[model samples]
Target: MPTPNQAALDFLLNRRSRPAKTLTTPVPNRAELETILTAAARTPDHGKLEPWRFIVLEKPALNRLAALVDQRGNDLGIDPDKITKANAQFATADLVVAVISAPVDSPKVPQIEQVYSAGAVCLALVNAGLAAGWGANWLSGWASHDRAFVTEGLGLAEHEHVAGFIHLGTEKNAPPERPRPDLAAITTWVDA
Candidate 1:
């Protein structure tokens, strides 16, 4: 039988993401955020490609991005409500770590795997923050996929894109636990 850490399992089972909107000030300091990022760096990487990087955003950067989002939305003729919603994330975030999916050129490791690794890093960062007693949430909106926004706003290269924005801060209020997916309905048993 495989050994299991009960505490870790319990934490995995009960861990819930706090809404970014509910996050407040008194965010993690540089040293603390670095510790969390270090923990996140342990995500699985195929071919050792290390196909991701983190961009820490403070108030100024976040505000600039929010303005960029508004401009891009207007340029693209996007819905006002949607643009407002997306802008709010950057406008209100106490701190954000933008995970960039920068896939490395690897003969053995496929591009999809590299992208998945980047996504893993995002989740790891969020979980690490929550474990460290901070409120964290992973968010990506339409602007993430917009070429103009990704290129000009975040300065992502052609081969790179935003996997997610990990928002971290103190929780202003406890969020109610939402209903979970039906595991039995989603699970499939493969038997010979």
Candidate 2:
């Protein structure tokens, strides 16, 4: 039988991501964020490729990103509402961890697997922050998908991509629980 830690199990069972828009000040400090990042880095990486990294964006960086988002929105002729929502991510963020999916060349590990690992890191970071009593939300708007934004705003390499932008801060208010997926409807038990 596998031994289980009750606290950890309980946390996972009830885990919920706080709304990024509702997050306030008193964000995690450098040391604290480093600890969270370390925990997040413990995700499964096929072939030990470690095909992911993080970029911490604080006040000034967030402001710059907000401006860049606006610029890109205008250039792309995006809807004003969509542009506003994307800009809000940076303008309201107390702190954000940009999970960069930096795939590495390897014979054993597939590129798709490396991308999956990067996604896992993003979820792990969000979970770690929530576990540490911080309000956290994983976000990726149209700006994140824009090549100009990725290169100029984040200085990402050609092979790198944004996995997520994890916004972290104090919870302004408790978010109500939303509808959950029906396991029976989605799950398939196969015996082959």
Candidate 3:
């Protein structure tokens, strides 16, 4: 019989990401954040490509990113409303970990596998924050897709992209549980 880890299972079943906008101050300190990053690095990496990295944005960096977003939005002729909302994300953020998808060139490891590894890193960071009793949310908006934004805001190279921006902070209020996927509809079992 397989041993059941009830506590871990319970935590997974009940885990819900807090809204980034609702997160407040008391963000994780450097030492605490290092622990979280260590946990995040434990994600699956096929062929050991390690195709992901993190950029932790503190107060000053977040402010600079917000300014860059505003400038990029103007340069791209985006709607003012959209720019406002996008800038707010960084302006109000207590701490954000930018998951950079740095896919390595490898004949054995396909690029798609590298992208999947980066995605796994994103989820690991989210789960690590939640397990550490912090409010966490993975978010990416229009700015994430803009080349100018990626380059100037995040300094991404041609081969790198932003997988996600994980916001972590204390929750002002616990968000109620949202709907969950139906297991029967989403899952399948096969015996061949």
Candidate 4:
């Protein structure tokens, strides 16, 4: 016999990310968000490298980042439409947690494993937000991958990279149920 957390399993079965643009004001406060971050920090890490960190982007920081994205897009000769979309991604959000993949050098752990740990943190954060009754979406775009944008806007280290920007806020509208992957199509059974 196995003990199972039914509530957690139910939440996982129904969890869906709300659209970033659809999230409104009334985001989690510092203490509340700290709780969510604490939950996110519980993600499994190979070698315990702890390769992930969070940057909470409040409204003012988001606004500044939005402007920086515009400038960087122009400097890089990116399409104007892309610039606008990315700018809106930041400008429209009330709160975001930037999951920074800060991989540390470890002989026991490969760099790719550290990177995967960071990615796991991102998903954990999104799930934490959702479980806490806040709408959350994990996002990343051109600005996140642009060196100048991350270095100047977020002050990331040379080795650190953005795993994702987990946007969190009040849900304006419940998103419709989207199609999920077919288990049979993607699953494999092995027996010996």
Better of 3 and 4 by TM-score: 4
- Give the alpha carbon lDDT tens digit for every residue of 1-192 in model 2: 999999999999899999999999999999999999999999999888889999999999999999998999999999999999999999988799999999999988999999999999999999999998899999998998999999999999999999999999999999999998899999999999
Question: Residue 138 in candidate 2 has what lDDT?
Answer: 96
TM-scores vs. true structure, each candidate: 0.97, 0.98, 0.97, 0.98
lDDT, candidate 2, at 114? 97
Q: In model 2, where is the ten-residue run with the lowest total lDDT? A: 45-54
Candidate 3 weakest ten by summed lDDT: 147-156
User: Judged by lDDT against the true structure, how good is candidate 2?
Assistant: 0.95
Residue-level lDDT tens digits of model 4 in 1-192: 999999999999989999999999899999999999999999999887799889999999999999999899999999999999999999999999999999999999999999999999999999999999999999999999999999999999999999999999999999999899999999999996
Provide the RMSD of all predictions against the true structure, rounded to 1 decimal: 0.9, 0.8, 1.0, 0.7
Worst 10 residues of 4 by lDDT: 46-55
lDDT of 1 by residue, 76-143 (tens): 99999999999999999979999999998888999999999999999999999999999999999999
- The C-alpha stretches of model 1 lying farther than 4 A from their native spots are none
Query: Whole-model Cα lDDT per candidate?
Result: 0.95, 0.95, 0.94, 0.96
lDDT of 1: 0.95
Write candidate 3's Cα lDDT for 69-163 as tens digits: 89999999999999999999999998999999999989999999989988888999999999999999999999999988889878899889999
